[model samples]
Target: MSWTTPSDVVALLRKRWDAGAYLGRPWEPVAVPLRGPRPGELADRFGEAQDWVRRWEQVDLVRLERVRTGGRVIGTNEIPRRVWIDTFEGLCALLRVGPAARRFEHLLELTGRRFPALTGWVTAHPMKTLEAADDWERLLAVVRWIETCPPGLYLRQVDVPGVDTKFVERHRGILTELLELRVDPVDGVPRTDFAGRFRFRRKPDYVRFRMLDGSRIGGFGELTVRAEEFLAPPARRIFVLENEVTYLALPETPGAAAILGGGYGVGVLERMDWPAEVELVYWGDIDTHGFAILDRFRRRFPHVRSVLMDQDTLLAHRVHWMTEPKPTRQPLGALTAEESALYRDLISDVYGPAVRLEQERVRFSAVRRALGP
Candidate 1:
């Protein structure tokens, strides 16, 4: 009654085969012993013994271990002790995964001949290899291109036939693992961003800013400059805010620059090379995520100050308070003493869970007051 069926043994081997263990170690022999009904269980479920025989006969590819057991009514009888599938072929046949297994075998054989260094990788990522089995040819084609092509080319610049930007981007994750195995150390910076790590040209990052006091920018009121080329103006102040409306409506202040579009993008500003002592002000919503962003922003730009993100401002805008569905509870190590106290209150739900005040909710007069004369 509690016997492991023929289908169950096949399912078990199918798992291992799909996992790539079969081809991962090509020289190693395969052996899986099925756990069938014990001798005592067989005699107890003698009524279903005929059904067991029918299931056993169906799995003709596997070798069986049999035993003689006595039942009160059936007398001494021969039954299967366990089933052994010792060969890869037999396991594949029983599981009916022969086609997939054969493909994996071919892949292993080809890797051994063409890319012997990937032997360890094949052993480590059996499942990944199987998932990419269908795409293995295209994937290897890209790998081969990376190996031969000049370093620092953009993904699109890869001149390999049938290998395009989308093809490489879609397979970046696995390619990174595979690329690292074959790519020269001089060409790879594994610790950097994807483009840098693989020595490819990444899409350039740009800084969008508004010249607060003077129209030093060309054409438009705002200037969007590539982060690498954007020279920081020798202006006395730089104000960064998240809200577009507030950024656009900012009243001109002498010797100041307004950086719009805020979130956890302070890292991107690192390339801007801002002056060490200039007045840097950040204005964000009076919420957990806002403070969290400000907290991270300060780590890189420690001199950066908060303008309207204070307890007084939060209390003044209670009418505009809204729920922050998923608030951050981690301490903002970069916050000043006062700001840290307010951040604690919001997260602890002293005002209640998810309480927040958007920077846009504050009056323009309040903004001017915070910015100062």
Candidate 2:
């Protein structure tokens, strides 16, 4: 017969006890006198004695067996008798008592990995509920905060609740230092220090010259001019030289200065604050990149003028003409009417793309003549 009701459960418990089936301790059966109808009645019929049913342990069904010793049962002779079939419904009823019933939902939600730690905390503080534990509150707070903010803004500014400006100030320095160390994936350099001070400073070889009034003047120290310095009044008469060697060789005028345009430092020129009445002039290769730089410069500073960057100069040095790999095809911006027409004819293939006249290729005498006698 299928084991049902309290009586059957008692019988099964007794059989298991007799068979020495229990693995823990010397099994002992304690007689619990039934004061009312069996626990099963209240559990199945009225639910009035549900707590008694949940707390009921079938001691009689799983009684301890005594091994024979002489004529009496010895202290070491006890063992469990046999297996007691525990139904799932009975197990569920047993677990619904006190704290276990209260924490049933939480138990169901815990994973195999998390259950042990949670159970340990519950065991250590039996008076407190699992939800009242420190770990639980911290975990909940973190989860709620994360739901509001994602991880991508780890170093970004955030306004967290209960976090004050003082707290931000405390960690701001450390956070900034960490960000400074992170290199750009594209260029593999600390992004914070990228595009830093491109210009270098060096003392120039002093050379004094007599002024137009025959008065002796002292030469100034070589100042490696940057875009900011180039914008100053002393550098108002801006002279751009394409060749570095020629730039170094040029004599400085009292108020005028030269820039070693470094090919593309022309772009840097766009950022400088030039003087309102400054006379700006560019001297580049009589070729495409040079003209393109001139074009770019004029676009930024429309008042800028080209010096000795002409077809006549290119033709005069025809013997020194060299081929350029990539010639400028796009029309320059803010070009003077004369420069626009001249540049068109030069790149039109009427002259040929191979035609190149670098400024450095021109003789010093030719440059002096172009500048002025």
The sequence of per-residue lDDT tens digits that candidate 1 reaches over residues 296-343 is: 888877898898899899998889999997899987899999999999
Where is model 1 more than 4 Å wrong at Cα?
Answer: 27-44, 71-75, 112-116, 123-126, 185-192, 215-221, 271-273
TM-score of each: 0.88, 0.42
Candidate 1 differs from the real structure by a C-alpha RMSD in angstroms, to one decimal, of: 2.9
lDDT of 2 by residue, 286-328 (tens): 7777788888887777788887777778778888988888887
Angstrom error at residue 294, model 1: 1.6
Summing lDDT over every window of 10 consecutive residues in candidate 2, give the lowest-scoring window.
194-203
lDDT of 2: 0.50
Best by TM-score: 1
Residue 45 CA error for candidate 2 (Å)?
83
TM-score for model 2? Answer: 0.42
RMSD of each: 2.9, 23.9
